[model samples]
Target: MIWLALILLAPLGAGLAIFASRRAPGALALAGAVVGLVGALGLFAGATGGATVSASLPFLPGFPILLIANPLTATLALLVAGVAAAVLTYALGYMAHDPERVRFFGTMAMFVAAMELLVLAGDWITLLAAWEMIGFASYLLIGFWHRRAGVAGAAMRAFLYTRSADLGLYLAVFVLIGAAGTSEISATLVTTGTPALIAGLLLLVAAMGKSAQVPMQDWLMRAMAGPTPVSALLHSATLVAAGAILMIRAAPMLPPGALLAVGIVGGITTLIAGMMALAERDLKRLLAASTASQYGLMLVALGAGAPVAALLHLIAHAAIKSSLFLGAGIFQHDRDSTALEDLAGAGRARRGIFAGFAVSALALAGLPPMAAWFSKDAILAAALASPAAPWLMPLALLGSLLSGAYMGRALRALWSGTDSQAREPVPFMAAGMGALVAAAVVLGAGFGPLEAMLGAVADPKSWIVPAMGLAVGLGGLALGWSLAPARLLGPLLTPARNGFAIAGGMDALVARPALALAGTCERLEAWLFAAVLSLGRAGLATGEAVRRTDREAIDAAIFALVERIFLMGGRVRRLQSGLIHRELALAVFGIALVIGVLLAAPLYR
Candidate 1:
């Protein structure tokens, strides 16, 4: 419990401190990462020793904020913390010259803190909050250079797309919580039948959005507008991983229909994204596409009902992909661009960095002795053994082939360019990338023990799976190295380069429609405003008429009558003047007139 608290607090505290002091930004971020890493290590150690630590603090009445250090979550915590530390270390050199280093490091630390909370969350409420935090933090980080061209748009696009999909998660959580009568994630997993199926599909929707699958994947390539370290952290173990992590955690609760949907989505994304990678002219965008493809393969494993296989691949990918990005970042620094054409011979100039890059690229291609090879094998095994083997196996194999092909193409491009003059030393950057690359190379050896630690059953070992993986991998690499992408992709090249936008992809499907709807709403609102204003004007006019009538007609008549009475009163007062003889004569005349009127009245009657 203390370790969990530290894991969440350390990075958060450091981030706040960086913002407050705005001094020694790199040092503060690194210290926070180190502390979080230590906490994760401690948590992992405890989990391995058969102890599961859980902390529940008051939140909602029934749904307390729960954090747990079970074997799986603990391992993920370690991964997140480790990756964060390495990326922050790399950024030390990457952003050394940037003026906003304080903002960058502070946001980075906060993002790490949010990711830690996400991985450790044991209940739906906590998970949802952490999920939102990371999304917002990623938005801040991705648009870190908001002044740059297209950076803000990319950040906004990423945010809007993911947020739209997050509705699925919200609905799924609602369904799960309602069905289970609790917000505890494990408790909700016990829910079965229609609720489970609905929740599963909804979860898949959310996963697709976050993990950059298919149509939702367009934003990811654009997201490369951010800093390289942002890419490294996001693509490797944090933001992009959130979707796959969600799926992996929820695998047990999915129905057959939902699982099939997941598999198909993954299969499509892997092939499509892999092609996008091959067609990419920019190195970072290629890597971004590759990240999507690899996560698709993880989805493939989950759909095959082998979440352990997905988990293993995820772990391996975190190291391999981050290492690849770090290497790319160094090259970008050297060339001042991420364009493959600009990066020609960048590897030759920095042979050491290039070596690390090559190793990780090959590892991603699933060659033996590398971490990804082992995990890829597990995924391939799962695919082969799945009930939908006919559908899934081919997709998995081709995805692997595409992985090798794109990586090979990237390597060839990097290696074939003219060597530039040696540049300045980047000791911090090199150290950070070196650690990840080493892990990428050697992390496979521990998979067996890791499986045992998680109590995950190892996939049945088979010669066919490895043999197939190697053949496709090698074949794809050879093809990419030998043939140009225009020749390889042929008719598909244009579509692939355009991200296979059938009918303008998301813009047509989501954005344009949304914009049109907004326009319609705006028009409707205008009409309503006009109508309301007209009604108000009519009311004012009616009130003015009533006032005019009261003043001219009714008031005029009353005033005229009052004036006549006043004149009569003045005449009557004059008659009461102190002339006695005149008064007596007037009285006698009045009496005679009254007598004559009475006599005439009686005769008429």
Candidate 2:
């Protein structure tokens, strides 16, 4: 519990310190990342003993904010911290000369802290809060250079797309909490039947958006407008990973209907995103598409009822993709652009960096002795053994092939051209990327202990899975290295380059409808405003008419009677002027008048 607290607090505190003091931001961020990494290590060690550690803080009534450290959460926490430390180290060189290092490092720390919270959250309440925090933080980080052309728009697109899909998560949580009568995530896993199916599909929607699956994927490519470190972190273990993490966690609660849906969605996304990757000209966008494809494979594993396989793949991908992106960042720095044409020989200029880049690229291609090889094998194996093997196995294999193709193409492009003339020392950046590349190289062998710690068994070792994996991976590499994307994609090239939009993609499906609804609401509000104004005017007119009636009719009659009485009083005063004789005559007149009134009253009755 204390370790978990350290993991969340260290980065958070560092971020605050960076902003408050505005001094040595890099050192502060690095310190926080290292401390958080240590805390994750400790937490993993504690969890390996099979005792789950958890702490609860009062949040919602009857549902506390829970933070738990188990094998799964601990492993993820370790990945997050590890990747964060590496990325921040790289950013030390990457953003060293920037004027707003304080803001950059502070936001980076905040992003790390939010991810830590997300990994540790044990209930819907806590998870939802963390989920929202990451989205907000990513928005700021993605649009970090808001003044840059299209940067702010890219961030906004990412935000709006994910937020729209986030509605599914909100609804899913409602269903789960209602069905389970608790906010506890583990408790909600027991929910079955319609509720579970509904929640599973809804969760998949949120996952798709965050993970950059299929139609919602264009935003990720646009997100390359941000900094390289932002791209690396966003694509690898933080914002993008959040979606897949959600699916993997919720795998147990999904029913067959939902599982099939997940598998189908993953399959489609894998194929589409892979094609997009192949067709992409920009290095970062290509990698962004690759991230989606890899996550789609994870989804395939989950859909096959093999979450451990997915988890392993996810762990492997975090290191693999981050290293690839950092390498691309190096090339970008070399050429001052991420365009493939611009970066054609950027890697060649720095052989050491090229070596690191090639290693990760091969790893991403699922070559043997690389971390992704084992995980990719696990995914293929799980797909092969699945009930939907006929449908899933092909998708998984093709996705694997596409991964190799794009990576091979990138490597060939980087290596084939003449070396760039300019050179710059990037000790910090090299060190950071080297650490991740090393992890990518050696992480394959650690899955055994990881599996043991989680107490989850992967698919039985099979020769066919590895054989197919190798065949596609090697074949795809050869094809990509030899042929151009035009020859490969052929007639499909246009759509692939356009992100393979289906019925105009999410813009038509979600954005247009939302905008139209907003427009309709605006029009409706205008009408309501006009109607209310008219009603108010009518009320004012009615009030005026009533005031007129009171003043002109009722008050006028009363004033007329008062005027006649004043005239009668003046005549009576003139009559009283005579004295005694006049007084007797007045008394007789009053008596006669009273007698006359009494007689008239009797007659009228």
Q: Give each model's whole-structure lDDT.
A: 0.93, 0.92
Q: In model 1, what lDDT does residue 27 have?
A: 95
lDDT of 2 by residue, 1-605 (tens): 77987899999999999999999999999999999999999998888898799999997689999998888999999999999999999999999999989999999999999999998889999999999999999999999999998899788788889999999999999999999999999999999999999999999999999999876988899889889999999999999999999998898899999988898788888889999999989999999999999999999999888888899999999999999999999998888888888788777799999999989988888999888999989988888888999999999999999998998889888888888676879999999999999999999999988888888875468788788888898988988889899999999999999998878888787767777888899999999999999999999999999999999999999999999999999988898797898889989999999999988997876
Clashing pairs in 1: 345-417
Q: TM-scores across all candidates?
A: 0.87, 0.86
Error of 1 at 193 (Å): 1.3
Report the error of model 1 at residue 496, Å: 0.2
Highest lDDT: which candidate? 1
Q: Using alpha carbons, what is the TM-score of model 2? A: 0.86
Q: 400, model 1: CA deviation in Å? A: 0.3
lDDT of predicted model 1 = 0.93
- Give stretches of model 2 more than 4 Å off: 420-422, 512-605
Model 1: per-residue lDDT, tens digit, 1-605?
A: 77898899999999999999999999999999999999999999998877899998998777799987899999999999999999999999999999999999999999999999999999999999999999999999999999999999899789888888999999999999999999999999987899999999999999998999987999899999999999999999999999999998898899888888898899989999999999999999999999999999999998898899999999999999999999999999988999999888889999999999999998999999999999999999998889988888899999999999999999998998678687899999999999999999999999988899989888578798899989988988988888889999999999999999988898787767776887899999999999999999999999999999999999999999999999999999999999999989999999999999998997887
